[model samples]
Target chain A: MSENHINISTNQPFNYCLHLADNSLIMGHRLSEWTGHGPMLEQDIAISNIALDLIGQSRNFYQYAAQLKGEGTTEDSLAYLREANEFKNILLVELPNGDWAKTILKLFFFSTYQYYLYQKLINSSDKQLSAIAEKSLKEVTYHLRWSSEWVIRLGDGTEESNKRIKNALDELWAYTGEMFLPSTYETEYAENNIGVDVSSIKIDWDKKVNEIFEEATLPSPNGEGLGVRSFGKEGNHTQHLQAILKDMQYLQRAYPGCEW
Target chain B: MILEKNISLKKIWQILEQITDPEIPVISIIDLGIVRDVHVDENNVEVFITPTYSGCPAMDMISMNIRMALLQNGFTNVKITQQLSPAWTTDWMTEEGKEKLKVYGIAPPVGKSIDQKYLEELKVECPQCHSKNTKLLSQFGSTACKALYQCQDCKEPFDYFKCH
Candidate 1:
């Protein structure tokens, strides 16, 4: 792995792939934090399993990105060695996991976005991306279903659970806007039929989320007025991302190309 | 790029059939439907395999195991390539593999993963007592490939190799 970061701007497809990869990697990392501390044994295992799936998906994307870069970069380098600013993940996934409700809500929101995104990506003109999308779509479908059930359970269960989930919805609603707003690379690739036009999926995403919320007996937070503020896809991220990087990149950074 | 043939493709596949999943030792990788294809071009051999799950830890081990198994069989030029297209589904698991899972105290996937039925609705018979009176404990289990379930009759909690 090279110590120098590869100039992602040189390659549009690479940037597009990184956006998808980073989202999964960061989301998977956040979910892995709850590995041992889940509310129960079953839930713990469930969250960990989901995390594993996301991480696995990220690996696929990173491997694709590395191949695209074709500059001696490997998936490990792309994942562990890249600076936080080089990441193209959306801000929503990089946010702190507040509570169990927050985590579940976040997973619900992200998986819903991914569910729709991968659906479109499966038809990408790019063969590798399409193949990856086809494979990952199955896993994302499972994730969306699992998180939806949890959201419904939390929202409609007890008073306290309902309150926490609603709070989670409100807290995370602001970050949802950026997912639909395409970055420069995304726009270019989407125009070429190589990447998903995220804006097109918002309606479906909204409908599914609203239906899930309704089933949970929870009122949907109004995301219409919440303008997109942060752009993690544009290499802009929250302060929380650096902290995540600190823990995640520590091994590779400290040891300088260490491997198990 | 062409060279004299050293081993038969049939012989290489016969070696792969001996390698079992590291996580689930009861079933061979061939029965699990992961070994997608095997191409033997003269002295070079390439095995194409697909992962059961995206983040399955066993894939790396499985790849290594396949290499070692082939190497032991005198095929030193083995190359393992992972192919993701068409994806993998539990529907591909052989009937013999499903029986092996049951005999190993694990329930095999009962229905197609594309089914709309809820986990509770799936009639996953208990591996221990072979009783239909079983309930889903969790959608996820000890690993990414399995779900947790318990038998109401025999009171044994077992793993169900989830339908992908």
Candidate 2:
């Protein structure tokens, strides 16, 4: 926020919530692309199931944000009507799912951050946010555990598997900086008890990532660009998000208020 | 208990108990613990329900069924509202529902939502042979609420209702 503590506007709150919802929405869309294509049948079910969970979380946030927005704007409108440049999700989520290893590793990093964030969120003074967090934290625990176990197995299991996971870690490590960086209204929302403390979650995220990487016998990538950060909160995204928006928002845009 | 209400609360409850969860058909919504509160304010009946999981797709169907069931039972103005606070937990599952799940070849959920540290250690008895030797095949299964496990003794694969 620099030296200026900007006044929190009313729309900023829902926009922040939109940020959370967009992250899950895009990540869910990316994960769903793996439907029937997982390396194994059980993993097929697992991955898609995870996609469903993420989408579900997005729905809850979108619904809340819609209510906060008032007027005829709805969760569907928010999800389907938004442009690529309008989305406030972190760039990491908007990135393409390159490979099975890359997908799992990315999910691992995101889930780890979410686990810690939601843990703090459950205690938030905002009762509605707390309730949503309380419900979401349970599912996220499984997501963290599920993805962590896979990361460990791939990183520690065999030479080929370990090599693949190692490559994945190197590729995805840069984007993690975005998760800790607070979005536009995040600082004020946290101060007012209406949002999460993302900065505080970094310590726990580091600890968990280190613990998991150690158990997996894999090296942790040096974060922070020498820890250089990226911005998706500012609507800056990788080239991949536009394509996702094209596909995801297509049905809604083309049909125009059509429902199945 | 009456505030100028024509229908009895007990009657509304019994009628609601007849509505089954769309996915897990063996258990009714009442046994599933989704029905949180049922208030009869004159002719209007407001039913508070909670989702079993964050994204249980059956919630809409469950709501519709509740409305139809009440309407058929002579209660016309029925309202089905969702309550997410105090999130739904497996602890709310009735004893009868657990037994029904076991008999239907799905191991009932074990452990508490708060005591997640014990999740990996929670022993699941095979619903098929009641054997304690069971291995988790996948943390997720056919539905969002279950996990796939294989029984060593019975050599049969079964669904274990995962502790939420």
Candidate 3:
């Protein structure tokens, strides 16, 4: 096979796996940032659980990626060794979790995309990919429902809460477009029915989001400039990912081969 | 001839179902989807198991329970093997287990039973009132695989079985 074809075959799955793994790892790390900073004790525990779930999902995807590479690369190595530009996650996941409203907004948007993505991935041609998708789709659905409800409550509640949630939506709106951008790797895998088509997800995402926004009495953001965010698939990332990597990879990097 | 083997397997299944989940006392490990296989060969019995999570603290307890159950049933040579591939998922939860959860006032998991994505999208019905108008009180419940939810109609907080 030509080098291009070989790259297309092998790296397609690898890149798709990385995107899935990175989404989980980055989102998990963001949730972990609220370890002791949540508004209440119960909410603190809740965020921690969300963090753990994401980390678990990341581990599953990373393990599968390692198997595909067939180089005995551990999940830790893939997670800790890759540079920010090498990561293939969407920018929305990498964005900083500014406040509770911002975090909720991010979760609502990401979970909606993930719910649809995994729904299609469950029917993937690859058995392992299908299994992972079959498993993760259940978790992401709960996450979407949880966050969507929060979006409604915060957006339609008190005047102050409503204003804060709206501000969060506006601030994070720029990053939403990256979630729908189909990468070269995704295109290749989608041809074989081994990966999901991002474009197809936008319709369901918009409908669900608009419904929630309408229920919350929040105005749907209207702007032609909304989808102009930098492309994360092309190695462009927000500054937040760099800071996130520093803390996330610290333990593995500090003491090599350290085991719990 | 074959009938005897079938009878023994059914008996083994019954014994296994009696083994309760260490973390959630109300449910059995068999219903929780941990026991994968059970086979008998002459005087030897083999039991295959998978953990809910890779490093779940309750695995030891589950193993001990299985051993004790078999020994008490006059099967002394029981071997338990752990299968890590095709990782265990919430989808393995039996229909009976799901119903038990609802009756126990915890919202059963819905959607791609194994995927976490479904946990985020599907509206968890109120365990107390069976209303879809329930809201999540917190993502974390008493256990790792559960979320706390409150019913808007009945105003009762219940646990939701979060997909792992």
Candidate 4:
């Protein structure tokens, strides 16, 4: 793995790859925060397992991105060395996990979005991206199912549970719109058929969300005002991302090029 | 040279057969369908393998074990390539491997992974008592490849290797 020097002016495909990789890395890190603090033992293991899967998926994308750059850039440098402002992940994943309800809702929304996105990405013009998407789609399928069930369980459960889940939804709903708003790299690659145009998948995402929300007895948030805090994909992020990067990158920053 | 290459290829396959999954020690890597193909050229050996799951921690260990196994067999120049295009599926798992899993107290995948969001009505018989009256405790288990299941009859908790 090459040491990550600041190459912010890289190609569109490279940026697109980082967008995908950063999403998984941050999402995995957030979920891993629940490893020792899950509500119960079984659920603890379950969420951690999912976190492992996301981290693994992020590794794949980061490795590919490094290979594309080919100037000694490695997955580790790409994951650990990049500045917070250089990250292209959506704001939804970077938000703090408010509670179990919030975490599950975030995962449900992201995975459902990924479900639709990967469904199209599997057919990407780039064979490697296609293969990665194909492999990831299966895992994301299980993620969507697990999170959807949790949403329904929380939304339709006891009165207290229902209230908590509703609060989570209200807190999280504003961030969901950024998922479909195409970043510049995304727009360019999608035109070439090598990347997914997220805007195209918004309808399918809405339909699935509606279906699950209905089953969970939760009202779906209207699409209006969803992107009030958008543009995370353009390297703009909330303050929470800086805090997350502080924890995730502390070791790498303190001990540069250190290996386990 | 041709005869030597064929011999090395066959020997490599046999050596791989001796390497079992690090997590599920009962099933050989070859039987589990992780070892896709092997090729030998002069003294160099290239092995093509696939990951069962993207984040499966066992894959790194499996690669290490393959290297050690090959090194022990005097195949010093060995390379392991990950082929991810045609993603791995449980359908490739050998019948013998499935039997080994059952005997070792873990239920093998029942059938093809439909890869749909909806849960399929797949019946997982308990390896302890051979009863299909088992309930899924969770979609995830001790590892990424297995799910936690408990038998109603024997009341024993076991791992079920999921179809994916």
| Residue A119 shift from truth in candidate 1, angstroms | 1.1
Q: What is the TM-score of chain A in candidate 1?
A: 0.95
| Cα lDDT of model 1 by residue, A132-175, tens digit | 89888888887998999999999999999999998887788888
lDDT for predicted candidate 3 compared with the true structure: 0.79
**For model 4, what is the alpha-carbon lDDT of residue A89?**
96
| Every model's DockQ | 0.74, 0.80, 0.26, 0.82
Model 2, span A101-164: residue lDDT tens = 8999999998998888888888877676677788888888899999999999998999999999
**Candidate order (DockQ):** 4, 2, 1, 3
TM-score of chain A of each: 0.95, 0.93, 0.93, 0.94
| Per-model TM against the reference | 0.95, 0.95, 0.75, 0.96
Model 3 chain B lDDT-worst window of ten: B112-121
For model 3, residues B37-100, the per-residue Cα lDDT tens digits are: 9988777889998767532557768998899998999889999986544667778888899888
Which window of ten consecutive residues has the lowest lDDT sum in model 3 chain A?
A: A1-10
Interface RMSD of each: 1.3, 0.8, 3.6, 0.9
lDDT of 1 at B93: 91
TM-score of 1: 0.95
List, residue by residue over B1-164, the lDDT tens digit for candidate 1: 33334337768778888999999898999999999998887667899999999899999999999999888888899899999987898988999999999999999988876644433367889988889999889988999988899999999999988877
Shift of residue B114 alpha carbon in model 3, Å: 12
List residue ranges in candidate 3 displaced over 4 A: A1-8, A222-226, B1-22, B25-27, B38-139, B149-164
